[model samples]
Target: MGLRSFVTDILPTTLHTRGRHAPTLVGEPEVETFAQLVDKLGYLSREDLKQVRAAYKFADEAHLGQFRASGQPYITHPIAVAALVADWKLDAQAVMAALMHDSMEDCGVTKVELIERFGSPTAELVDGLTKLDKLQFSTREEGQAESFRKMLMAMSRDVRVILVKLADRLHNMRTMGAMAAHKRARIARETLDIYAPIAHRLGLNQLYRELQELAFSYVHPWRHAVLHKAITRARGYRRDIVERVRSDVDKAFGEARVKVEVSGREKTVFSIYRKMREKHAGFAQVTDIYGFRVVVQSWQECYLALGVLHQLYHPMPGRFKDYIAIPKPNGYQSLHTTLVNPLGTSVEFQIRTEEMHAIAETGIAAHWLYKVGTKSSANPAEVAQTLGAMWLKSLMDIQRETHDASEFLEHVKIDLVPDSVYVFTPQSKIMALPRGATPLDFAYAIHSRVGDHCVAARINGEPAALRAELKSGDVVEIITNPGSRPSPGWLNIVRTGRARSKIRHYLKNLEHEESQALGEQMLTQALRAEGMALPPESAPEGTSVWPTLLRWSGNRNPSELMLDIGLGRKVAAIVAKRLAQLMQEQGQRPDAVTLTLARYAAGGEEAGATPPSLVVVDGSEGTGVSLATCCRPIPGDEIQGYLGRGEGLVVHTGDCGVARRLSARDKELWIPVAWSEEPVRQFDTDVQVLLRNDKGTLARLAAAVASAEADIHHIDMGDEARGETAELRMRLSVRDRQHLADVLRTLKRSPSVLRASRVKPERPPG
Candidate 1:
């Protein structure tokens, strides 16, 4: 029988309905009438179809009373979704998953129950389709992030899970017109931002197209309607152009002795709208709105067709791409080229082999062909890798490291971004990263250790900044320093959340260690001031020191108590008193004079008998006593500490405007703080110098500051000045206030110096 005759004859002739129960299955019932559907799904045997049917029946029974917002039976939605998956010729398990997509959420079906009924594979797919309703989150964004996290992690486990989920989402999006306006908008936005990109990444072209069209309609309804109308009208006008192009391409290929199938392809409404927005053009200004795909039998014919097309029209300059040689990360392979036709209109042409066309159209779904056909050469691993399923590995890693749902969601979003660049490693392997990612992200992409020790990088054989934005096709090589660690400043510029989070985790632990040491030292000094001896490093197994410390700080353990004390959550005076009590209980008594001095210090009076100890203010330190970034206080400045909520004691200069305002309003928040006799590290001080606009003036100023035993950390000069004076903001390192004063004096004595003053940078209230 001819193809048309077979299709027409196999079409359903009778309609059956379970009146007042299930709706009648109407139109094209070839599967039930003649088992044509089973015959066509060559990859699935009769046994597989029987299993799938059993799953469908189970899901139908489970969701018997449930209905969707549109008032249709819930089982219909899953059936439709499953049909869509079957259309992709996915595996039997994936089809079963699609059929039961809503069972867990709507019918109270549990994963364990599904596993017992449909096996682990089907249960896992259903689990992936399940949303995060069980997880508690403070905000809608957090919940959404968490749901996405769960979905992506599931997808990483088995690519089939996402395929089924995408099918489920696609069916819902197709029927979204029945949803509320606000819900439709939100769902559409999410689809455009996430699901569509995921489909594209998986090389599900048909699914991607459907998702984009549905999302565009809800996101920009009016624009979408207008574009649809315009496309319809344009198609009418271009009917002859399409035919002419098709005929010329056919003839040209014939002349070149290359067999090809030429077909006209119209641009989708979403594609047109995107082009118009990106190029800032009106509908009429948009070229390449219509294209032709030339599917040939072999890669050689694809190249031959490309040459034939170029000879047929004036090829546009720099408008050709050879994707066949290096398929996109999504595994899309085609020879794309744009040409100016005889009518002076630009048109795009895509040339590809029949197999490439299949892959391009179905994406990773094409891998199923191996199961159906005699060609069993397809590599499942390669297909999975090409579809970017490796990103799922990171999801597992993220889950292992982070327990916060919100943070997990954030990591998933960072990893799911569609705009990615594929860069080459030194070993010639490819690493994918989001657009605007830097070399540091790339290093981290390879391995966390590489990122931690990455001191420098080279791009394409030339030295580049670690923060340099990577582009597609670039070869990057990381240079590591063995002793190097991730810098705190890197957090400000790193694009990937993984890199940022890892850096923060490292810094937090490092700061805690330093703060513990500092706390220990401060406790020792305070004890010495009380004329008491230091405690032993390790207490006896049954000693009460640990319990005493925990009671004093209201913490569960010694580490927590120490961290609280170091963070200034517990005052030093209070902790010292508790320590003294514990020591007295241990039969250690303090001198009467020492007790008097401790009492005086607790009452905010100076202990003249004891000298003040040293406290450091290096940028490397992180404790409750943090120097305000806004002020960058040096040792010479009179600083006070503010015990902020959650934040420990934030130090600010006494003269800082912010500190003055905070003290005026909340005076009790401020605590007395004095610089140590010998600061452990250099301090940052700001100096403003007004210099006459003269050559070598900045050099002279730098020399004068250096002459005073100070090093310049940063310098900011104003743009062109109106008069002879130019303002310069300089950050200098000094040991003490006297050192800063000496630097200021030397700057005032410099030549061409119009004015000089200590610039007190404003500090943020803690």
Candidate 2:
């Protein structure tokens, strides 16, 4: 008999008769049995099945003493999972991997052993399924993340690895009820949050639905039971409605001269619960509970059937979606239209070709059906290839960038969200984005460089802010600027984790460069204070100076030595002493009197230098020190330094409220610091100007500050009182005490100004 006849004959037995104890067949009924499962191995050659069976037998023996919590033979689980793969019509290697997925982890079998037995391809698949048992993690969250990372990296190399893994997870979820209560909930929640969505994104509707129902049962048992009972009762009452709809669809298709098969579909319990919860309604309020699907012979027939249904029933306005015309990102295609049925209830109808229907129902697994047939129009493998390629490519991209499993999982979670808005590029190429993604996300989705240089954007030919939230069907065109750089604030608005992580990575590297430059300066200044010029541009002759420097700083390399000094991990003075000693041993000496003078002068300079030892506040050369943004310090303010772990000397005013709390709590991090003569760079101070209500008062205040040769970096002007007076907090830069005094004088002279004073901004407590 043909495969189709075999499928038709066995469909009932495979789907419905498994749990039922039926009477034994008499006189050898023509029924497909477990032996047929072996016969179907023709799709994968008999020899391959023999090898797979050998591996299965080995796994069975390795798990001989083991049994599941349900008291079933441990081998039965692998067989069931392998059956799922067989149902998917996977190639021989995938089948072998599925059969031995648990061997490495549960049976203590090694990849080497599997390789020697089943060959390398099968062994690699088994290895990919193994967890990182030997590694230690700081927390369960960390370990889980790392494990996900490894799986994704492995998946990038072979799409079959994840497919088999997902199949394994699906089987486990189906049987999760046998596990303990807490374990069930955790596993179910993970399945719902991670696995189910992944399955959906990969177009695995069959696995997706099963996983959802399984997870829903455990995540909300009471709700699942209630919904299941309600659906069961509702199905009984709606039996007439279903039959009528089916008859109506068939008759309508007959009238349209379109041959079609009509079927009734009921929403799953999990779907019903989700609609109720999401819409904030009771179960009765949820519509679209009853749906009908029309499967036809061709795409043209699908449209004809859709027309026939709409002509028969009134289609709800704006409730129709023609995915066949514009497929979803996951390659799901169907013509969906919701209409008001004869019963005056909203009924959703999905019309598609038989092949499309198979894909819609079974997703990538529909490839199995085509493999068994020779229909010219049916090519499920091509469909699976198209849908799976993009998803696997993205997984590969994420794995290449992230090594931490938790972080990889995070990226996957972000990528897998079902809520996506479809947008168009300037050239009209469609792109789907996670909801709430901004223009920056669109740029990054196109390319990393586009995101990095994206300065502005336009939606529908009108300029929009970079942070503007994108919606479906919008035509987006990113505006690039050569000098634009990503700001720290972008982290707050960007939705996609890819954009966020890339921006953060770039900024971190930029900060490191700045820190390195600052560290080099500090080291040079410290050496100068020690009455020595910088060592020869290269290491001195015959000294092995790099090793000597490493020994002195207790570091691995010169870069690390400099980074330590720059980050205040080691004192500059101590490093200077070591450098001086090294210099003296390298045939360099200083006069006793010159050294004495240098000591006294250096002491005076140190006393007057910036509070942070690394920061040099020169009154003359506008170059060295900077006040911390966290707690901005000005001249004449009592200040202290915070060796902020990785951050170099952060100067905070001593009497500032924020600094006091940080000092009280983190005394070990606090370090002494002072100012230098002729301070070089400008200092920023906050000055609050309380001005009488006036029109041009704000502009005049800014002009006055500018006249005083002080620049205003930022300004906040708003009503502080209910009426009349308004307060303006201005963060302005000044050269020194004299410049700040001049600016304050000018501001005080303004007629509209009621009160003007430099106020110390309060900082957050440590």
Candidate 3:
């Protein structure tokens, strides 16, 4: 029979029939019994059934001596989980995988063994369900994060991995009473916080509600009992009211020439407690505790039935929602409305077609089994392949940005929060983003590159700050620049994990490049000091010496060694010495003439005289070198480079007291250095400006600097500035000494200026 007829036309077997049905309480039937499992096996071929039985026997043997906390054979749990998968009419492989999911972890069942026996697909599924038991973690939370990361990555590759795992968890929760109270509470909390939400997100609403209720019973037994009794008592007291409302709804639909089936959906204790906590309301204030689900035969009838219910009672303003118009992320579609009954108590109603009801009940799982009657224009495969799988697709994107399993897992959790706001692109395309997302979030959602280069934003055609919080219906346009790069400050404001991870990734790459260049420069300077030259990459011996050098240095490649040098984890001079030793062993010696030229070239004024240890600063060194922030030395300033053990090279102004102190301590490490004729980028230098006190004087100082084409990176005001003269200490980015001099000259032209001079360093970064 076809799926629709099988699902909708066929009625589930009653308990007395002893036939296949939805899961029921234990003792009604053993899940492993031929009748219970074989009944659902009609969809599987004879060979498939045989394969499933073989897996069951293998697991049963592996867990032969094992028992659960309940003192039952461990084999029973896998059987029960398998039964749940069979109920969903999943493929024979899924059923087999469920049977073997725990064997790998509990019985030391190997993937190779499973693959040899049951094939790769089943083995893969089992592997996905297995946790990383062999690895040690710093904390239980860390271990859990890592385990979940593995499971989620597996789920992204194949959805059935999580499906079978959820079933396994459900069975465990069902029998959680057999475990210790503390263990039960912990597992239940995990189920409630992670697994249940995942089920709901997957559209398995049947499992979602049951998991919540089961976890609730274990998490707060007393509360569950109290709420259970309260609901029962309330049910008895309101029986007449409930019957009256149902009777009235039926009659209203009948009179309106509509057909509908109404069933009550009760709130779980946890849900009730959560709603109370979130709304800051008492139990009595919870209006939707006992809501009615109205299932109609067709989409048209669903709306017709909703109208009849609204006509019967006054709808509470703002309580109506048309989910059928825009279904949830999980593809759940329904029309929900809360109305006041004649007795003045609030009553909630949900209206949906039969197919919509099935989808709502099953969620993601509905895509596999819910081929109900033609109430839906789209098939389950189409729905599952598209809307329900959107989150699964996003997992790949998140993985692209984050590599650390724990970090990826954290981002996945953040993405799964369910609540989000819908926004639009400049082209009118719609995108759903987590609430509190910013323009950066929008840019990343559009594309990673867009987010990387984004410099500014425009919301609704008006210029908006990059950090501006995006609202629903806002049309966002991202402005990008080739030169503009992600700033470290963006990490604090960006909302989505994708944006945060990508920005971090870019900055990390940029830092590594800078560090590598610095490392190379430091090594060159170190080799020059040793009266030698860095061996040419194309030196004889028929090839580059870097591979040989890298092998001896225990480095994977040249960049890594350089990065180590740049990061201050390894000293450039030491590496250079070892490299020189290698080259000397290879019959190459330092060119004496070349060494003299390097020394004279590096020395200032007294070129050919007894030369000093000479180093050069070009403002273009990568990560391996840096100019001291304390001294803020620019080109044309008398400078000295300090070979700080493993800190590569740090250049400082020669006259700066901080540099003098450092030189005194590490006198051998200090070397004379000169600036390159032209630098690639702007260098930041401090200028102490003395100005007349005036309201616009500060603005004039800024204007003068801007007119000179200088950018003020930072500004500091002296305490004495509030008196007769203002002392503004500004760090300005300039091309060279000429550029800085021009900026100071411009500031002097203003009548408010008294004197301008470079500020010497007081202290240096540690």
Candidate 4:
């Protein structure tokens, strides 16, 4: 028989009679059994069914004799998942992929083979679904993170990948009863943390709730059982109330001459459990456990029915929300209100149109139901796709900025949270953000450039701190300075992942650039000690010198080598020595007179003895150089530089006890450093004072420090004075050692002070 004739004529008959009425079958009955189920849907063509059958046969053969933990044929699991995808009305490719999703992972089926047989789209879907178990990782979490990252990337590219994967996960979660307790708990937690949130984000509300229910059952079985029993008893007692509310709502709508459908909507067990946990209440205290869903014919009718319901029952104060005007981030729209029933218990009602009801239940899956022409002639599939598109773009944006797999996953998890607050821009455009987001997050949401240059903000026409948390309906305006850059402190205040990633990316790039410049300066000083000039890559004669040096150092490029040197990953003197040798080989001999003078100035260069290169500290080196907090060295403090690995340069006081201990073991990492003629910024150092317990002692100390032109960054005072004296420790920012000495003298002159001195690390015992 022909393909169409077989499907149209024989398939339905065979399905009815369980293959007894079949005329002829082209594949195994097991494959035909599933194909027959899909054929009954009348969604796919005969050609599509043929391809699906081919995939099933191939997968079944690949997983031949394999059984699940429940001892069911492995092929049965794939069949069930494929049936779920078909229920979604996805394309034939998705259905085929669902059937063979585990073939590549469990069986030896190769993507190439699948590609040759079923085509590229189906093969790619299977490949995207496969986990990264075969590869090795240092930790199990790392391996799982990488696998999830790959799947997210794939899903962002093709939404169907996730659709099929969710179906697969749903089936697995359903059959998890046969697995070991520990394994079930682990899978349940993963589903709760990742998969369930993803589903909710995608607008797959039905799948989301089901996954949450299943995961909660596995993660906390005892709680689930207790909660289930409580809900069961509550349902029996509340059955009359539910019916009465339904009847009353029906009559109210009828009297108002509106066409509507009223149905009893009960909260899912998981939702009820969550509410109890969040509110710290028992089951009886959860008044909105039983609700009603009013489906109207039109958006206008939805509002009209809302009025009828309010007149029927007393509406609860501050319990009405109009989401239709401002839909949720996931595109869910409804009018929610709570009312006190006759029994004095709260009853919630969700009022929406038929179309909104569909979206509310199915989310993105509602796209299929709205594909045809509707009253508005707008395709909800496009609307759903648009909603998903915004988040997908964010995923790509975050991926571009973050290269580490675990870090990317972390950012995604932060974004997957469902609570959001809507605020407005100066132009009246509404922007929805995660709850607890600050004005910096708003700026970053506007644009990365805006975020980088943001200096301050004005909320509701009043000046607001940049770290101020934004509330719904606030009109926020970001103040930008053309020269401003992000500060490291912003990372602690910003709440959104996008802002966090952008700030980190900017800081990382800034640090790298600064490090490169410092490394070049250090390398130049080292080369000068060898009586050779550092070669410039742009110059024709010096091009070979850098490449030769990089090859010898196993570095890929000059920038990377410079960055390494600046980050203290490589010693500048060693690279300079090797470069000098290469330059001499090219017939460029060192100037003997200059070499002698340079060596003499550098304290004599010996084999393996790096001459002390005097690097001036001007207090504006950014992250490439820092003063050790333990020593708190300022200018003119007899300072030495320590090149800590990956920590750039750390300046320490020459006699700092901490520095002395480090120098004992890492003697070679030390380099000589000097103060500049002028310093641009003040340095912070610790100061201690012993003061008599007087009412104005702190005020006198503050006045003393200010009179000496020093700023106290922080102050610490212990609780209550012991005997007659109290010790005070404060961090003060000063210009130099002379300024610190001046502050010490001023502090000692105070009547409340018995002694004052710079706080230093205690020395180790001999």
Models, CA RMSD each: 6.3, 6.7, 7.4, 7.7
Q: Native-vs-model 1 lDDT?
A: 0.73
Q: What is the lDDT of candidate 4?
A: 0.82
Model 3 weakest lDDT span, ten residues long: 1-10
- CA lDDT of each candidate? 0.73, 0.72, 0.76, 0.82
Displacement of the residue 500 alpha carbon in candidate 3, Å: 3.0
Candidate 4 lDDT over residue span 625-715, tens digit each: 8889887888888889898889888998988888888899888678788788799999899998999988888999999999999999999
Select the stronger candidate by TM-score from 3 and 4. Answer: 4
Which candidate number maximizes TM-score?
A: 4
Tens-digit lDDT string for candidate 2 (86-143)? 7778888887888788988888898898888888988988888888766898888887
Best by lDDT: 4
* Predicted candidate 3 versus true structure: per-residue lDDT over 1-766, tens digit per residue: 1012111121122211111112222223547553577777787888998998898789889989998877887878888888888777778889999988888988888999999999998999999999988789888888888889889878877788888999999888766665667887899888887898888887788788778877777777766666656655666577677777877877787788776677776665667877888999877787666778888888888788878888999999988777776677787889999999998788888989877987887776666676554346665444454654668767777777676777776677667665677778988887878788999988888888898889999999999998888887799999999877777899887887677777877766777787677667667877775667766566673155678888887889777887777665676678888887777777777879867776575663565464444455787664346788877888888888776765667888877778878877867666567787777889998898888887788888888889999999889885552677777788899998888889888988988899998776785455
Root mean square deviation (Cα) for candidate 2: 6.7
lDDT, candidate 1, 551-590, per-residue tens? 6578886666556656656655557667777787777788
Q: Which wins on TM-score, candidate 2 or candidate 4? A: 4
Best-to-worst ranking by lDDT: 4, 3, 1, 2
Kindly provide the TM-score of model 4 when superposed on the true structure, using C-alpha atoms. 0.88
Better model by lDDT: candidate 1 vs candidate 3: 3
Against the true structure, candidate 3 has what lDDT?
A: 0.76
